[model samples]
Target: MNIFADFEDRVRKAVEAILKARETALPDLSRVAVEPPRDASHGDLATNAAMVLAKPLGVKPRELATEIAARLARDPDVATPEVAGPGFINLRLEPGFWTGHLAAILKAGGDYGRGRRTGHKVNVEYVSANPTGPMHVGHCRGAVVGDTIANIMAFAGDTVTREYYINDAGEQVNVLARSAFLRYREALGETIGEIPAGLYPGEYLTPVGEALKAEFSDRLLAMDEAEWLPHVRDRAIDAMMAMIRDDLKLLGIEHEEFFSERTLHADEGGKIAEAIEDLRGKGYIYQGTLPPPKGQAPEDWEDREQTLLRSTEVGDDQDRPLVKSDGRYTYFAADVAYFREKFERGFEEMVYILGADHGGYVKRLEAVAKAVSGGAAQIDVVLCQLVKLFRDGEPVRMSKRSGDFVTLAEVVEEVGRDPVRFMMLFRKSDAPLDFDFQKVTEQSKDNPVFYVQYAHARSAAIFRQAAEVGVRLPDFPTLDASVLAGLSDEGELALIRKLAEFPRLVKAAAEAKEPHRLAFYLYDLASAFHSQYNRGKDFPALRFVNSENGMITQARLALVRAVAVVLETGLGLIGADAPEEMR
Candidate 1:
């Protein structure tokens, strides 16, 4: 399945054999990589092991490449090995080797490309949208990206926890409370005037107001702002979170935990104070005045002494204040506490999915991770770029219902969740995506999701035809690899090679924390499948179900079934549907 890994081992053994033959010392070999050739014409695989080891052994790269190639040709799986330019060793595997890969895939079923267990606890925080309003389209990209990353990490063996951080303790929630109170008065037959400025004016708060009115009739109207704010704030936050969760469900996303920012401010052994104390004892905390940031006039800044974290020592651009001049904990302070909570709960790896606006926060967050974990834990931040929704090449300016920007729910309703999620992941997370409504909903091959899903559906249709034609294909496991000997067509071989690359592709994408690679891989695989299917139209003998020759048909059927399994598994990871038939 992981042919690259298998060949890498073979290359390593060949190097060891050469070292033993010469009885010479060698340097580290961990960096030696056996990968696919840049040009497929070179070979099935290429390795730079000889070039990497040559200098340490005091030999020319070409000489070392020759020695490695000679030893590699002895491998039963390796049909040919040659030394190419710059000491690259290119290898082509035996046809039976790729054929056996089909068997491996069939045996594993949906789990064919997944990696072995790594036993690492990873916390992935994404789409922590403020619980003050319905989720808009702006939140869609980060939500899909984070969810896909968590899914890929789990498939690639890490224990993943999907999390959302609620901004409940912020001033925005107070504004939400005020917005709801106005709606509450309206619910009780009070004619409240136009919503005041600097407060939430969205009509989504009307229901929250109705709910408050139902609970206490008019008692809340008699209380002071301070007395009534907490009651309204909790209810509004709960209502907003419920709405957000429903919106996320439309896209098939559900976080395992929704961590509240309020939890960090608990008076009994407060986490914020505790986190600060932990850092203070470690000598990374100080009280000081910071210099004005670059390019800013001194008059434009207000200098004051405050509690600060020595984030500069851990690679941050400057020291960060943990408390504000107003005697309230800063946002960074809450972030540190939340991070410490996750760390104490046994997460060794932390991944943050943020928007482009939060790019400046990466280094400081990484610094906090280092300070809290003493460099034992790792932090990775993925800053998702903007997404511009377009319709027929023109940008969509507003949403009819929200009257501001398009809500994520509205987008899902327009084109369906499959298109929304797939198109969002069709590109890398950090790249700005142009989501065209007309293109994604198209039923043609131009749509990547449709093309990939059609591949699975086409495989199913082929099996149905196979049954109708009186050619009973054997179970996938019973299809002997030897039967594939009849499949000598270059197209068939190339398709098989692509299928064999799935395991390696999954590993590479997961290690890089980039799930978009899988999307691209599925599209490429679908193109190959579609191309091979089209070839059968010109050459009838290349058809998958040859009624007169059941053995070969059975072998091809096995390959088809494996492709369906992989396509279904891949679509599921990215939260897209792999339909049995296109609608």
Candidate 2:
């Protein structure tokens, strides 16, 4: 029931009939598209059929537009089809069309905007924060963006797998192990003074230390560093990941897969060796020396030959190293193996939600997907920019729990999950976001989450008011267009049009891998609904409830219920809630 898609078919049919009557060969209709007009006042829907087909048909643009508009004007659902500037066709649908669609919305309810399954397996990897400490605010935007993208993708008909790559094999985890060892020593009654430099100072590790003391006691004390390091590191990673999971759960995020980096390095670098060998077989790997980076050479840049991936041949800026001069596999090697593993797992598309700082990895990652799958799979990288926290226009920094940065849990705790999740997505991910603690919690239209949720609350209140007036609304299953014929008001039809945009919005946002669009659409829908509600205040006949007339009241109630359904479905997709009552 996508009106735009439906009309696109109708417009194409009209063109085909016109061509048949003129004895003209048919032109490609794929380029033709039907969409909402940029300005609502122009018309309800706009199309470029005539403009796209005119050159091929050898007809004047305005002439073809006129012919198409005349045919569309014959449709019972179309009130008018006018030829606008540059041969675009603007259509205003009949009142029955809008009111009928409103009934369809109620019948569909939660499933109204759901898409048909595409049978595409998409792997969305997001919020792969290192398992070294509790998740901080720096990871919040990517987390919410990734989770919401997964939600939208699933709703958009892709078989989406939510994944998190655990970065537990790096030197950072080793540092965490050593830091936890210090806490372990303190837990054993050893008067270790201040936390030494180059070690984590956050008290979150205190519990990890206590847990180790309870498990291994003084046994670790006698063991050499080499013998105790692995035991302590594994334990510390588990503790940190547990804390991280709890923090994510507070924001309603959970990954279906948590692929550990250690697995790739297991069996004495088994997976990495296989990945390198595969690349070598494909002639994508070779021993080479990379030129010094542009402008200046990094300190770690070595002039000696090293094992490298021919990434530049596949679109990377330069060939990337697979193994260092020291004979240890580089971090890029692990990434290559991880991608290969995902490819072998049968994913047709891989989506990476990364921080803005990782922009450099985009081309190289795309190269990896190309080489690993031989262009059989696609890769998309979404980068989220930094979020600056403020309170009443003043910057707020530092968290006692995380020592230097604010923890994700702290942000969610301070403002609640709904505000944190909605506001995180209120802006495009590529743009920097300024999150104000006080502003998001305000119970006014200035607060987007509150405003949207308040719309749902108001809808609920409308039903209660209808009930008090002795107007028993018809059940959705029994409601039909006949009951909705009273909804001929311009504002009511406008609200219905906004609701009608949901399916198209969901499809577009999911295809673009931009969940922020959903937030924007929800806000727009809320504004339309609130405007209609306010209009009722000035015009008594425009009110949702008319105690003196039950028929129109039922029709209006159906419209309000449709709004509630859409608001709930959209909020759920973004990992937020739609409350029936704001208070």
Candidate 3:
């Protein structure tokens, strides 16, 4: 159960009761909130009901706070409700409340913080890197962020669909085909020279070339460019996509759907035409001339009239072009069709996890959702900033396989999947992050991944130590409440307080679409657990396994087990592992 949410409801009800007794109209309660006080010393929970509602109710802040405090003091779980500052109310819960919550945690185990299913369909599209090459470090952050978002959203009760959009119909695929054709010729013992400057130069395509050689042998060598281009392009896209999938699997990511962009252009551009017609019927499509560039005009500036989508009528900065000067549908047209397809599939929300470079596409995408869905659906774009790799303080620039950038597989191979996934989410997705290879792999508290996983391992070690001491921890199902009476130590209570925040934390992080918050919260929880363990070392009475005292020992073991359960659940949400042993 979310104690904060529970208390928030109680606080609101308390105010409503106060209003009812006075025969006054109840003010809006939406602004009222109950949360853990910023300073633990203040109290267990704090609320701003008095401060936010006093003016609307025509009452003084402190006067209203005193009234609310008196009403809240009636709760059996609230030990004391004190009014502090101007109008804030701080609540100190009874010690039994924490221990009882710890029992609830054990009862719930891994499902302690999981939300009730809402069944709202959500499509999260991430790591849609063109199926042209292996995934590079440039795409790693968005991949992890997107995957974690889907995981947390599912845990928070939404129906999540992990998706990858393959840009296989683009000019880049044609370039890839030519690159593979060069390698194919080389594979056939033809004296091919160095790759052209415009073609992909990575040797990763060498395998694709060899595959084509095995499938068609020298027969492809005699075909015209027009005849063989499509054959090579399709094969090359498949090979690149296979490699990309393997790379994603290295990070524990697997999309439920892999959407091909080519399908939108199929049936003689039927889908794109349909989307345009739909928008046109709704008065969103028209022929127009775009204004010139704001600053010094670029070399390609043209003022000719073209088919356009009146995106500005919705929310975009400008009306967008639907067709290029060459009469082919523009990329924006494909985006419209793609969004329409998703809406038709019954997705209420579409989340796009894109690289920082795609920040300009946000408004246009939002306009598309509004126009095509007729305001029935919405789109949210999350941009992941660049990740700069460092090896022991020196910048790492090149990869042997990727040529210009580090491959995601190379990063995972060097450090490991857990470290890469956890560290990628260590910073806010929109902020630039510097990932130090050495620091992340270090086996110390300074490394967040190690620090958090060590907490789980330490809990396991506690149970084992208890067993060695001939103290069999009682099963949660049969444990008695009296067994937890001796768990009144400040350190023990503090850890429970931290554990109590998990459900609230999960809901907040999921709603904000910020998985980094989970990473930070897990670190804080680990710190609280580690601190309590260290306290036991200094004072024998605070130890988790007190063989001489069976009562307190059972209580502490229950706490340790709860910590391990929460750690495993949080780690799973972030696509990381909670190891039972650190080594």
Task: Write the residue-wise lDDT of candidate 2 on 454-516 in tens digits.
Answer: 999999999888888788878974696898999989999999999999999999999899999
Task: Tell me the whole-model lDDT of each prediction, alpha carbons only.
Answer: 0.88, 0.92, 0.92
For each candidate in turn, the TM-score is 0.97, 0.97, 0.97
lDDT of 1 by residue, 1-583 (tens): 6888988888888898889888877578898998879899998999999889888889999999999999988889889999999899999998888888878888889888888898999999999999988999889999999999999999988999999999998888998899899999999998987778777777888999899999989999899999999999999999999999999999999999999988898784289999999999999999888888778543213388888999999989888888767677877899999999999999999999999999988999999999999998889999999999898888988542333778899899999998888888899988899999999988898998888989989999999999898887787866677886777777888888888888888888877888899999999999999898899999998888888788788888887887888899999999998888877
Off by over 4 Å in 3: 296-301, 399-402
Task: Tell me the tens digit of each residue's lDDT in model 3 across 175-292.
Answer: 8999999999989888777777788889888999899999998999789999999999999999999999999999999999999999999997899999999999999888878898
Task: Report the Cα RMSD per candidate.
Answer: 2.0, 1.7, 1.6
Residue 369, candidate 1: Cα error in Å is 1.0
For model 2, the superposed segments whose C-alpha errors exceed 4 Å read 56-59, 296-300, 399-402
Residue 295, candidate 1: how far off, in angstroms?
4.3
Q: After TM-score superposition, what is the CA distance of residue 177 in candidate 2 from its true location, in Å?
A: 0.4
Give me candidate 2's TM-score against the actual structure. 0.97
Q: State the lDDT at 57 in candidate 1.
A: 87
Candidate 3's C-alpha lDDT?
A: 0.92
